[model samples]
Target: MSLITFHRIYPSAIPPMRGDKSALGSLPAAAFQYCEAIRTASSFGWYVFPPLDIELKFDGAEVFCFAEESGWNKLSSLYFEDEFWREWDRFAPDDMKGYRIPYLTTLFVPGIVQIWSGLLVSTASDYSVLVRPLANVVSHRGYQVYEGIVETDRFAPCPLFINIRLIDTSRAIEVYQRDPLFQVQAIHRSCYADGGAYAEKIGLGPPDGVTHGMSATEWDGLRSTIRSAQPLRDSQIGRYGAAVRKRAKGQENID
Candidate 1:
């Protein structure tokens, strides 16, 4: 049997408040339930990574999110590859900015079910493209935003949980082929020492833990890109609002 290790990436903007004894203490039970619902519905294993010290502050947001060290490491290492950087520079908001946080926190749903022990590839230039499979197959919906709700007398800031799932990649690719925003590449199956494996059976090298933190220069580049693309992002979001709304409403009915 192949061992598949799963990792969860939380937004780095909302960390626990100071002196909050419980990690989930400030978070809503509803949010936790929502996460559980996705896990159960997807039949995929997942767990929250230990809290790390990274903190992000947005212009209007009150609470800051804390990202686990591993999570930061994973993202930083991915950004180091030239190919990954090139693509990320083209698409992501933070690519040209100075270490800005992602507006959205991403979740990974494995494409292959019977994966052997997999390494969280930090340095592979190809892994950046590999992530397309997950992005292509995964669906998000049911976003209910609660603003300034208090749970157990502790303040819980606005929390949003959208139901998410992994669609059949074959079907997704068929549809995705027509979209201008995404492209599907050929899938490859192979093996490596770091236990990298995928549904397409692609193999990757061992993880490099060394360069997990983004430098100031990289952060600046990302910020610049975000500023330049603001109008485009707004336009896309506006045009796709109806479709997004439909998906959100239909999430519960997906199973």
Candidate 2:
């Protein structure tokens, strides 16, 4: 079966206040408050994904948080490395150039999946698990209020594909259509007594139940879409991926 991948790139860097002394001073207090809020909310049958790390970047004078990793070790070497910052800066706006020395923290979240799986299953089980944890992270870390540009290719993996079925497809389509980075491939389905059979309309076979399989064309297409939506502002993207690839090649820790 052909699987469609969705990739999204957020253009704005982490806000400045998130790295201020006041923010840090309040963090511990905030953490306790947020945890209580999470527990209380969860008791009412809410799923909350906890914060894994709180990264603060100091580009010399400006302090910002680039990305918050949840549902996994937010403090991994990869996330802390200078290479990660380089890659993140590649996506930063033109005005944010020439910044150095950013502070970074890793927020904690539970249940991070490393393997790829079919859109339906992954979205339903793995992706759904992040909603609460993300909320918790944001509750303490603060909201990322800026809207940045986004681009999508036809074959990028969709992080939210499984959740798509839980809502109205037309509404999904409408919302994604307005976003620069969102892309959706139409699926064809045949209903049966047990369950309906679904396949990509473009002759891609049914979605694999346990595996995430895709054609090279599809994968490349998705990559293209992401690039088109949010072309990297710098070479940081290449450097970051290359660093990761090098580490993986050397049998070093790569996630």
| TM-score per model over all chains | 0.16, 0.17
Measured on C-alpha atoms, candidate 2 has an lDDT of: 0.29
lDDT string, candidate 1, 1-255, tens digits: 112222222322122111111222333554333333322222221111212222322222121223444322111111122543355456657645344222224334322111101112121222111222122122212111111111211221112222112233222111111111111121222332145654432223333454245556757755543324566453332223334344667853321
> Which candidate ranks first by lDDT, i.e. highest?
2
Residue-pair clashes, model 1: 29
lDDT (0 to 1) per candidate: 0.26, 0.29
- Tens-place lDDT digits, model 2, residues 136-201: 223212122121111222222332211111111121111111111111222222222136555543
In candidate 1, what residue range of length 10 has the lowest lDDT sum? 112-121
- lDDT score, candidate 1, position 4: 23
The runs of at least 3 residues in candidate 2 whose Cα sits more than 4 Å from the true structure, single-residue gaps closed, are 1-52, 57-121, 124-138, 141-255
Evaluated at residue 142, the lDDT of candidate 1 is 15
